[model samples]
Target: MKNYQRYTKMFSMPPVRSMDWAEKTCVEKAPVWCSVDLRDGNQALIEPMSLGQKVEFFKLLLKIGFKEIEVGFPAASETEYEFLRTLIENDLIPDDVTVQVLTQAREHIIRKTFEAIKGAKNAIVHVYNSTSVAQREQVFKKSREEILKIAVDGAKLLKKLADEAGENYRFEYSPESFTGTEPEYALEVCNAVLDVWQPTKDRKAIINIPATVENAMPHVFAQQVEYISKNLKFRGNVVLSLHPHNDRGCGVAASEMGLLAGADRVEGTLFGNGERTGNADIVTVAMNLFSQGVDPELDFSFMPEICEKYREFTQMEISPRQPYAGALVFAAFSGSHQDAIAKGMQWRRDKKCEFWTVPYLPIDPADVGREYQTDVIRINSQSGKGGVGFILQENFGVNLPPKFKEAMGYAAKDVSDKTHKELKPDEVYRVFLERFVENRPLFDVSECHFKQLAGGIEATVTVAEQGKKSVVQAVGNGRLDAVSNALKKHFGAAYTLTTYEQHSLGEQSTSKALSFVGVEGDGKTGWGAGIDEDIIQSSFEALCAALNNLFVSRGKD
Candidate 1:
């Protein structure tokens, strides 16, 4: 935090105010996405992916709906050269997908790059040179005229090579580190290159402006993009692109702003894997648009599978909190959050809502290949009654009464707290079964029979306790009340039947009926559940279970 005077902003704004981009609230459509995973993402790895791995990654990019993918700098090494040759020789490149290869703005490299893409149906020979004040003064030590000549010579060679090779190839030029260059100078260099290419409506040129090192706020980058977009020659025939790096952790923001500034395409890596901090995360950016009702054109429905494969290929661990794609992105572990999410989900289902407006979740997890039971309402010590109840009803078809859910939640939380782990859905169900459902330690009801009376029901109950059984009879207003009275009389018990509810567990005539019962005694409450084919029998059993729990709470078990 000390000696901050050593650092100054590396980004320079275009002289004109270009807040017009700010007028646009959101990106209206998907940009032409180019995956640089094979080139930019691969080079930054501690061990770059092998030829086989690169092939798999390339196929993945194709599957993800990318039409333009930067394969690699084929002229840089034998591996790179062989990879391109393999794709070309094996006819791996699809007819619709255009494979791009990067080259430095040098003649020999340009010549070798053309050889790599020689008989391709479609390709983009991307050429770039560093054009920043620091890069020129420190790395290149070349004047602006010399830097401009490098780009111009490269453009001329590409044009000459395309003529000699007799291949219809698209051209792409990048003013690498364009953010640190003066906007006017960068434009000057790009327009000069465009002049050599002489792009037209039929064969357009691409001018990619890369934030090689982010050194200013995102607004500055947007302003620079707007300036280039407005002043570039052959503007209607050019595809303006943005390649933002995340040195300032603003790559996605900068890319969004750049799109709003009239850039047509985006060049980034999945999960933002690239040099330094990384490229703008194309997944996050695309999903952001997808959430906003724009089709990102990329299929991420199998996000978990994508995450698994990405880890396998790149050997990079995605943080659990990574936006949209991480393991715990949709997980609601806090008690209040879980409660709100549970109610919101119920409200959606009750209202038959067509849009996803769940509380605390920007997008539905199910929309991205995640389940509601496990992915959304995860159970931990910090979990709440609503989440616990949601897990039961959604996963196991056991819907507890609202009051019983609180008790069940407490029991599950205690287990999780002591064990220092999260409780899964089945584990929560098991806790419910052991604590409330069919729970009888002091006594068990072997059978029950209800008989109609004048204005009430008479119940005959057979009770078993410590290997002994007894039959008792009593009368009440309802069958369950009659059974409760019979049991209390036989055991000398004293408790009020405060609540009872019942419902069918499944949608069939023979489906089991689930019953919940609650008893209050000595300022303490006890809850229980029962499931049986007959509602009457289930309620009788529930009454017995509730009595047993009441006995336990009174320290009689």
Candidate 2:
């Protein structure tokens, strides 16, 4: 903290007031998404992807609905050059998708870039040079005129080469460190480049504004973008694009704000994989628009598949906390969050809601190939009754009674707390069976008989306790009540039947009946569940199990 005085802000603001982008609440539509994963993202990796891996990634970008893809700096290396040639020679480039290649604003590099994209169905030759004040004074040691002319020459050569090849190949130029440059000067250079291309309606040139190294807040970048969008030449024909880095961890925010500032395109990598903190995450930005009900025009419905392939191709790990595409983004481990989510899901089902307004979830997990049982309601030590009950109902057909779910919740949390691991749904179900349904440590019911009577139903119940059997008779209004009375008489126990519920496990005629019972004794309640083909048998077994729990609570065998 003491060294903080060593640094100062390096960004420059636009001269004019360009705060109009601040008035927008959200991005109204999806921008033209261009994935730089093969270029920017791959170069940042510890081990750059091989040619085959790059090819696979390119195919993936096309499948994900990207219209423009910045393949790589084709003039920089043989591999990059060969990758573009591979796409063009093998007819891998789709008819609708345009492959864009990067180059320095030098004659030989510009010529090599043009050769790299030869015979492609559609392509954009992108050129850029450092235009920041620091680059001007230190890195390039060039005046503003020299830098602007470099961009202009690159633009002129791209036009001449395209004309000679009889290809209407589009042109794109970037003031590479746009964020660190004076906004007005950056605009002047972009206009100079645009003048050479003379972009038309059919061949609209892209003027990319890259953060290069993010140095300011997102609002500052948005204002700068607005200045360029307002003053750039051939505004009607030019596509204003934003390429933001994540130095301040505001790449996605800057991209969104840039779109609000009238930029039409975004260049980013999937999951924000790129240099330093990474490029703006196209997935996060697109899904942000999707969550706001705007169609992002990209297919991320199979997000898991995309994440897997990204890891395999690039050897970069996707963080478990990454937005929308992460493993635990939809997971709710907090007890309160789990409870609210459970209630919200039930409310949706009961009301047949047409829109998603679930608590704690900005979007439906199912919308992106995630399941509610496995992905949404994850059971850990912090889980509660609602989450436990939700897991039972959603994964299995076992819906615990409202009061009994609380007891089951404690049993599950105890196991998870002791094991120090999250419990899967089936493990939770096993906990339910071990503690409630199949539990009979104190006693078990061997047999039961019932006879109809005028006042109530008479029941003859046979009970087994520690390998001993006993028979008792009692009468009550219902079969379960009669059995409860019989058990209390035989065991000399004191308790009240506080809860009873039942439902068929399935719709078939031969389906089993499941019953739950609760007994209150000494100001505490013990719960149990039973399943059998016969309703009467299941109810009796449930009563017996509940009594056994009550006996155990009183320290009786």
Q: Best candidate per lDDT, number?
A: 1
Runs of candidate 1 with Cα error greater than 4 angstroms are none
- Predicted structure with the largest TM-score when compared to the true one: 2
Q: What does the lDDT come to for candidate 2?
A: 0.91
> Per-residue lDDT for 348-430 in model 1, tens only?
98999999999999998988899898899999999989899889999978878889889888989998999999999999989
Candidate 2 minimal-lDDT segment of 10 residues: 548-557
- Poorest 10 consecutive residues by lDDT, candidate 1: 540-549
User: Quick one: how many clashes does candidate 1 have?
Assistant: 0
lDDT for 68 in candidate 1 is 96
Q: Write the per-residue lDDT of candidate 2 for residues 305-380, one digit (tens) a residue.
A: 9999999998888999999988999998888898899999999999999989999999999888888889999999
- What TM-scores do the predictions have? 0.97, 0.98
Candidate 2 stretches with Cα past 4 Å from truth are none
